[model samples]
Target: MKAVLIIVLIIFTSLSSGKKFRWCTLSDLEQRKCAELSKTLTAVLPVTSIDSFARISCIRAHNTYDCIDKIRVNKADAASLDAGDVYSAVKLYGLTVVAKEIYEQGNCVFAVAVAKRGTLDIQRLRGVRSCHNGARWTSGWNIPLGFLLARNDLSWDEAQPLSQVISEYFNASCIPGVGVAAPQLCALCQGQKSYVRDKNHFCETSSNEPFYDSDGAFRCLKDGVADVAFLDHLAIMEATESEQQEYELLCPDGTTAELSKYNTCNLGKGPGRGIITRHNFQKITNKFLTMIQRLFGRKGKERARFELFNSSSFGGKNLLFRDATQHLQLLEEQLEIAYVLGLDYVALLKGLGHEGSSLDNRVVRWCCISNAELRKCEEWALSVKSDPLVCVQGTSMVNCIEMIKSSEADAVSLDATHVYIAGKCGLVPVAAECYGQVCAPADEITEEMRNLHLKHKGLSPVYAIALAKKNAKQINIHNLRGRRSCHSHLYSPGGWLLLSRYTVGALENVTENCDVGSAYQNYFWKGCMPGADGNLCKVCIGDSEVEGARVSSRCAASHNEHYYGNMGALRCLVGNPSGRSFGDVAFLEHSNLLWNIENLKSSGWAKGYTAVDFELLCPDGTRAAVTEWAGCNLGPIPPSTVMTRPVTVTKIYDFLMKSQEFLGSKLDSEFHLFQSQKYGENDLLFKDATQYLVPATHMSYQEILGEPFFQLAESVFNCTPAAWNHVQQHPPVHITHSTELGSAVLIACNGGFIIFLGSSRVNALD
Candidate 1:
């Protein structure tokens, strides 16, 4: 029985589905034009088969309101409507606007007020007689009224209605469509008879009234009845075409546009009428958009046979679409129906005036280092009151920086290295973390002369140091070839960067094509280098695996990677399986070494390692005791810096300071805030070594890194590990045209030949 009913339903639906696309129309003339256009479309359209293609049919309605209702119920497919009507259709029926009508040179037109030159100014027109197109219309109502509400401090009471306020503001105004309930609103109407729908000759929405539409409102001003005419820019342009010297446009600032340039000389702008359809008919809307553009567009071939844009008989006004429209503009993804018709305009149409919703737009969105970083940021979010802060997480630091630029996230903490890259990519640094508590003020130590030594407690410079076994006498500091090595991570100051600089500079005849990771892998027999992906992770022996990810979380540069960071690298050297490949040397900071030696149980891999078991490798081809790190250190590395866009640098700096005062220290035991042990051997959001965050004295990357170090770092940054392969083979030259290989051309006057060697090289004429 179910199968039989399904077959019957399918057959019924298929039979009911007609071969014509129905478009809703408001008048009889539009229906006639629709029929004529449908017949002409067959010949004009370039479709392969006309019989299979849908034909155009018109569904007539009394007004736009009825047309929208019919379209919503699937009685008709589409209709063109003004922004005001479009807003109603979108709000009530969830309609999607496919395309908008383009007039003059813009997809939108502005509403303007016209008055006799030298007669009156806008500021003094409180008691002047005004002629409006109609109540609740774009040009006549929403535009002028919305602009006034936004700019002026109109002393209106909550008890008084919008119509009453408008009536009181303008002494005698012809605002058509105002009901009889608001008698003061319609007091300016010239018609003597009582309020009637279509019978009244004045202050009515239809053509029966003298000041109804754009033309009529301008006519009221032309005949010397109204002091000012409130209408669309197009209407004023059309009115002044024959009588150019009759009137002038009133500017917002009480000035006048003596010569008409509607683009610049207009009041408030609003989107024009757009073709709307129900949201459910997405496929139909797509097809209809293509067909309509082919039929009625500026370059449309069908428009040559039958004019779809213009209306001819039966009232001779705008029918299916406004006749004055030059072409149809397809809206992009960013623009929506509600957006096209602004919020203020929509509010006015719905009679809900804009009071305070437009104000109080302040939100500080913070970018997190990792998913785990969100926990602390959430706590911070609760603390902030004015300009509330919210947290958003990204996969990596790169992702966070990108999110900030795209407005997905507002700010993120960055290392000094990352600070340089972010600044190059159009981001600015907000504050720098000082090692000590005593900062020499933000401006006092901005220059290089000042030491900027805050002398704060519990903070000191982190130093890059090399570690090796106490009994390891087989490998010398200068000759580290074939010795298993461990690194903190790639690009880290104490690991890849510092080591790469020393090794590459010390090694003889080193070319640019040398892959640093491959070289490190080849240099070491077998060892752990955490956060190394692909070939770089060849020797990394991570114990734990990340849950359900294609990327081995063990090899990740993030906190998820088990064998990651300075401590992880140190553990790789000391805790390698007794018999198997154990790292002979480790590159890490001096502070992490002391911390791990003191608390062996903190890291899973640091079980059996002790301070007496390891020694530091100095550059002078000698190994020294671990306690002598001050003399054996490679270099002093700066602390991690916090950065943000220049727009909110000050706000972010203040927020950071406030947050640190409460939750940045170990005193907040509820959560070990900045301490790495809280997150299990991971410095997720901030470095665990950092005692506190302080304002950066130096601003630029060049300033932070002294002139000597800046020059060296810049040179190294310019050339990647494998840059030799990309080096220019010869001097580059401009080529007129691409030629085949081995092709040669003889010069016209000279006995020289220009030869094409390949795609890149060309032998020029001599």
Candidate 2:
């Protein structure tokens, strides 16, 4: 009786202590395989005394994202994810890689471009028809595209969809899942195009798309529909002898080699699929994976009963894990997705789906502040039929910046001051407005000038001048204590920051905290400083009071205010169409000074005003003609930059460059991108004086602004505690979940199993 009681107690304790790991399944077949594995694990539990061995349970998820969500919320514990999905899970969802599937090629695969012998050279593939396994596929898309981008063979404007660039690069392609977004990419596809009975599967990411996976892509090349096929090294080896003999691997060096030379001639190498779970659950998940591999792996004691890696019995291919996976290998160290996947591969993946990299993938949402800019943006959207643009409205410039940061809007063109603020909030400049003859378009640029162009492109610095009517000689820079003023907007580099630092900071006994805004309000008697309240907004007039216009827009820091921007400030000083001037002095940018005067005269806003009527106030309290702004300005200000999330920098740059090519000049009678006079606004989307949009790619905000200007901005803004707090709050996205695993680790195959290793083993499951 005592022995039986002891045995019962031990059984009860084992049942209570056993942990049930819920494995997430993506499809019905995966669910079936997971259930079978669970039952097999349960059956073997009585024979194993390992307390850490978890009993498996199946949890069905809609897809990889759903699986990640489930694991994050603790509804599921683990799932096997592809390299791309693994990156998303780890970086975005904070999941950790516990183990990886090792195939004959170890834990990584080589991507190769395959073509019929002498069909085409790798470097000269610009206008050829191509075949790809699928969109975002590691071997077919990411690796090859990344390789081309690195080689400068392919140019990506960070502002547009990568698919657009690919579609334009290749004359035609059979890129699965991309036909809907870019139809030209699917021109070579051989799928059923009829929609009857749901038969339209053209360029779908399935068997329906004749050129879908590695096999399909290879078949595309074989059938002569595609000149080249992008796939993994294994795909070529899996091809028939005759097929392999006919196809040759295209090397990165613009040469070709036999199919067997994939190891030496390949686009790039990328990591294989891996199992992921919540960071805190990595240890238990690793142990559970280890237990399953020991039981049903290739050399498992119960291999005859069930195979862990094989899913053929369940009427599916790669159901729970890849069919080619030899065995589940536990990572000795918890490696980051970037380390597991090569840095380049990780970057490519990030560029595909990083924060602010438009989720829609079809249209870029340009944030427009005020009705006038929105009207112009809407017109711009209508004109660009090829690349659709969606106009999103914000009440103020700062609001637009916040919208972009939260990804509500994709991009916005900002002045130097706003650009600095955007940079602090993790935004980057994609393109900059070039306002003079110094800027040149893409076709006109030569190879030798490319480096210099890239560095100085869009960097046409403008003079920040304090403009006053020639008749108002009493309103000099030194004695403007009680004078009414007109400013471009609050925090504007040219219109506000420079003026404040040199005049307010130097003359006024303001505190070190740099409350320049308050000092400006106290110093100037009345002013039209958009975004400021009280006396600062007293002299401001809101948008031409149309029937339905918002009266609250009077003090808004956007085009909604009649007294906004360099042009608006000029308008305020010269007077509106009624010839009722509001201020004695105006602070604005000199690059647009003459242009704004011309626009105001043409638009009949300041009909009689000319550049001769305006004079720039010098630091020496003397006045100079508007054309002599070179020496009379407060300081040189950086040109306005198109700012976007760092990840979408290239995409934004690409979009702007393309847009400029299509609708940049005023000569495009249909619509002019730089002219906003017709919309009853000045510099709605870009400054009217902008000669062209230049690439600011690879240039940081500091580099774009130059040290002198950047330092001047910092001094005026005071690098406030709030800004430092924001930096601390939002560290670089990549380093947010970084773990300090004692030493650098790498994966290697040893004794027929793959394992992560440093100098010493950390958590070897075997």
Candidate 3:
């Protein structure tokens, strides 16, 4: 592995927890003392200190220089340490012997186990998200792997040392004379070991190289290259942006799942190792120093350090627990926080569903502002009463801060550069920026906020901030000096360029140091070519996601009744707005659903879908709301319909039925609204579908091709202009056919022409 020391130096933007105060949180006296001390402190840095001896130390976000100057028994002077060693040196100088930990914001599972079986079992976890940071792995990948392997009838002997386990799996899956089966795992390493694809899908070592190692382990979960992945603190704060989305916290035991029925057992515990503060100093301090000396003692201290950096060894636990008191108080903290969230046993059960939740039911509240800008933000925050965590955005810096102080919001999520800048000024940044979109800054500085001036005001359009649920993400601290950019060239996997969001973050803002959490960039105001400066985004371009939004138009249901389909049949299934317009791939798969113009563009279905498929189709000039009457006697009857089958193959009949019920209920309340004011209602074509669903016999697809509606199919095919459509249904009509075209009729015909090809018509064509 060539000591794969790819240092990815990322600025740590973790919060000290809402209850745990960060530096900017210093009281008046603390702040005054700290500022006075800063004059004496020369070297201060915000980073974790793990010595060759494995001693841990820390300083407040903005109190670095001053913290060093205060020089209490546990504090070290800033000037005494190197740029990187400042924190550790200060700790040593102050004689502080406390051991701290690096934890992720949210984790899927935290497994700690000896890999006797050797296999990194990813197979069992199909849909569940796993964390990337490995700190909690004992509860995450390891234990989960064990449970799965055990279930599959494998023991430590069979799974041992990853390599053997993967090979054994390959052999078992392969039949002697049969052709190779599609591998359940990623590509194979030499012999039986499983390997992962790099950013580019080219063949290479997986988790084989140090920097790339975390990726391979994560890839098992990320690209579905593997069933599960390993995560630790570094993976969270430091992984490239693209890696964030594939996972989230493991749902705790007895929690309900989004799908499925029946109660499931808890996968594991939901507790965390606390930063147990050491209230009793003298005794603990002496013991901690001794441990540090052992770390430096000539006998294999180097080996011990490896354990500290890598969560693969129990040796790592020593750094976390040695001098730190279990802070038994953390138990109270945990209980109280849970209470604040209003979590209950019943809610847990409902959340877990039948599968049993594998993740903690608790959610972490992550605020995006940097630590340096707390004072202004806090003052602003104190004034607001609504959401506690806020992603601040606006034309004026004062306004942004005022909102925070006025109880208008809590955290101000922002880019790393802005976040860091805020910390330098005095704010508590809970989580680093991951990825998400926002409107870009104006071309010129229309406001002080955009210009980077703290005290200025007056601005342009304020970008909208959309926050992900608190529990939905993970947080990590990065070490910028160590990055794997070098190996990306040799390890391109799947034809994708691999770059961390941090790397891209640095590139996007022209500001070299920055951080963030999660992934996605549509609402981003930074990172594009003409963005904040020069920061690049660590995202796979060309990929699209669907987002749904509220519109000015109200649901078309009459007076009081709620109609599920009235909001439109596809409402629940619709994704984010920027989602790629319906294309060939999604359309054929969901051929039965009704869609308007927006659905076609968003789903990428416009390329092949047709208006004839819609229950009611509208063109660009259609009205948003209308009332139509049927004039023809035959047309006065309820409309008819034909269904091929549920398009979602994986969904069971029950799920499909659920979807129908869900959509059908909206029929009255939601409707296809037209844009035009005055439109024809006297014609039979204007009649609303009276019957819920009229069925028709199934016939050869060719028979469908011969219907007069096929001519109108061109209009459906052109469904990209946000066309509106909504129609009631008729009774079910089923028809079976052999090799030839079968008989069918277009009911709900609105006197619309029916062009059926029977024997005589076919003979004429021949």
Candidate 3 wrong stretches, greater than 4 Å: 1-98, 101-121, 124-275, 278-661, 670-766
Which candidate do you rate higher for lDDT, 2 or 3?
2
- For residues 1-766, write the lDDT of model 2, one tens digit per residue: 3443344335434444456778898556778888888777666555443343345678876446668899999999988875766777777788888877777766666788999988887888898999998777777777777667644577776556778888899999998766477888888988778866355666765555667667678889999998999977766765678876788999876799999988788875666778888888776666556656766888777778889878789986667787788877677566655546544344446555543343556578899988888889998888877887999998676777766754568789988888876675446678777766666664465434444654754355788888888888677888888888889887788767788765666324434325566667778899898887778888888865633555767868888788888878887887767777588888888866677788876877767778788788999889899899878889888888898764455556667777877664335357888777788777888887776666776577778888887877666544333222222322111121222211101112122111211212222111
Candidate lDDT (C-alpha), each: 0.58, 0.70, 0.22
Off by over 4 Å in 2: 1-362, 440-451, 454-459, 506-513, 544-549, 575-581, 598-602, 606-608, 664-668, 718-766
Q: Write the per-residue lDDT of candidate 1 for residues 336-374, one digit (tens) a residue.
A: 443454322343443323222232224567887544567
Model 3 gets an lDDT of 0.22
Regions of candidate 1 where Cα sits further than 4 Å from its true position: 1-366, 369-391, 436-460, 506-510, 513-522, 542-545, 549-551, 576-582, 602-604, 664-669, 724-766
TM-score of each: 0.46, 0.53, 0.20
The per-residue C-alpha lDDT of model 3 at residue 206 equals 16
Model 3 TM-score (2 dp): 0.20
Clashes in predicted model 3: 188
Q: Which clashing pairs does model 1 show?
A: 432-696, 436-456, 437-456, 438-454
